[model samples]
Target: MIAIDNKLISDSVLEAQFVCDLNKCKGGCCEDGDAGAPLEIEELNELISNYEVIKPYLTPEGIKAIEKQGKYIYDTEFGWVTPTVNSGICAYGIRDEKGIIKCGIEQAYYDGKLKWKKPISCHLFPIRIQKSQQDEDLEYVNYEPRQDLCKAACKLGKQLKVPVYIFLKEAIIRKYGEEFYEALAASAEVVKK
Candidate 1:
């Protein structure tokens, strides 16, 4: 583990290569999870605040699910999460012409509708974070590749020589700040040697 700030980052995040093969996975992560996308407390507010702006980007089924279930729902294991349609695709998901699922919230952000892109948990996919039991102040960040869904991504990552940390640089920086990412890069350099 590489310790930086309050995080204990797994070496796999620096060693394992990954790049989302959206064409292959077709955004399966958004659909196959047992629950909806995990949301931080603040993300709940962001969804509520931007619902109107984000609504247009959503599919009819998605809007109905959100309307019936509210912006977010509580899960026994995941705490607060975005509501899912028929307990499947995320409530904020829409399908493109190619039938690939896409995040409505992210699309709205790309369209200049909202400042927040999407849920941090969704952004930092394949790297799940949890509070460390060993230390109250520290969190554990680990690479969790799903074999069925992420096979193509793993293959692409290895082919491109892009490590997980580098693959998820933007999301990691967004969650932990630029200095934290710099520290991770430095750690990666040491690991390389």
Candidate 2:
């Protein structure tokens, strides 16, 4: 494990490889999960505040689910999370003509309607940031690639020689700080060698 500040990063973060190939995966991570996308408390508040702008991007079914279930709901296993449509896909998600589910929040962000870019958990995908059970203040930054859905991503990463940590550089920086990502990069140099 590589310790950086309050986070204990998994070795796989430096060793494993991944790069999302949305064409093959078709955004399965957004829809296939049992629960909705996990959200931070601040993110829940942000989503609520931005819902008016983001609502236009979501499907009618998604909006209905949000209206019925609230912007976000408390999950027993996952804590705070976005409400899902029919207990399946996230309510804030929109399906494109390609049949791929995309984040309405992200679409709003891209269209300059909102500042927030979806949930932190969604952005830091495959690299799950779970709070340490022993110390809630501490966090585990682990690389947890879905074996079934991430085959193309893993194959692509290996072909490109990109490590998981490097592949998720922007996300890691967004969740952690520039300094923390720099530390991970420094460690990757030693670990990969």
| TM-scores of the candidates in the order shown | 0.98, 0.97
Regions of model 1 farther than 4 Å from truth = none
**Model 2 regions more than 4 Å off:** none
**lDDT of the structure predicted as candidate 1:** 0.94
Clashes of each: 0, 0
lDDT of each: 0.94, 0.89
- What is the Cα-based lDDT of residue 52 in candidate 1? 98
Q: After superposition, how far is residue 179 of candidate 1 from its true place, in Å?
A: 0.5
> Per-residue lDDT for 1-193 in model 1, tens only?
8899888999999999999999999999999988998999899899988999999999999999999999999999988999999999999999898888999999999999899999999899999999867778889999998889999999999999999999999999999999999999999999999
Model 1 — which ten-residue stretch has the worst lDDT? Answer: 130-139
- RMSD of candidate 1 to the truth, in angstroms, is 0.9
